[model samples]
Target: ERPNNSRFSSCSVGNISAVLDAVRDGRKRDCLKEDAGAFCGNKIVEVGEECDCG
Candidate 1:
């Protein structure tokens, strides 16, 4: 059950590969932590990516 004042929801990934594999297969998650391999997002950006409209 969810409380009326609650402002968020949650879920779980049955398998680690579920999330990783989805990202590899071109699916984007709600959020991603910044790292050296990726500066802005999990998706690798190419030329002109800076001007992308979200």
Candidate 2:
């Protein structure tokens, strides 16, 4: 986990499974599987914690 960094954390994942699910669930607009978590900066895929609530 990224532990939630104020400067925008990331959940970098080698697998594209999560990305596919996001797209199907409408949580994500669109992206390239080859890009991995490089699609968006605010994406949860890159920000594993995204400034953890805790």
Candidate 3:
């Protein structure tokens, strides 16, 4: 379950599920690319990423 905070308050279960499904199905691959110096904070938790607060 998501925390009851303003950051995730607007995020619905359906929306999060859809995103997770897309990631699992490789549909979000194109959007997961990161530059040489960019790793986290893009909002999409890619492989090896621990967390993304931004």
Q: Candidate 2, which ten residues in sequence have the lowest lDDT sum?
A: 6-15
Give the worst 10-residue stretch by lDDT in candidate 1.
Answer: 5-14
- Higher lDDT: candidate 2 or 3? 3
lDDT of predicted model 1: 0.54
lDDT of candidate 3 over 1-54, digit per residue (tens)? 357554543458678778889988988866455677546776767778778776
Off by over 4 Å in 1: 1-14, 29-31, 35-54
Model 3 lDDT, residue 13, Cα: 67
Cα deviation at 40, candidate 3, in Å, is 15
**In model 2, what lDDT does residue 49 have?**
50
lDDT of each: 0.54, 0.55, 0.71
What TM-scores do the predictions have? 0.28, 0.31, 0.37
Q: What TM-score does prediction 2 earn?
A: 0.31
| Model 2 stretches astray by more than 4 angstroms | 1-14, 33-54
Sum up the clashes in candidate 3. Answer: 0
Q: Please provide, for model 2 over 1-54, each residue's C-alpha lDDT reduced to its tens digit, 9 standing for 90 to 100.
A: 575554432454434667878888988874754544433445445444545233
Residue-level lDDT for 8 in candidate 3: 44
Sorted on lDDT, best first, the list reads 3, 2, 1
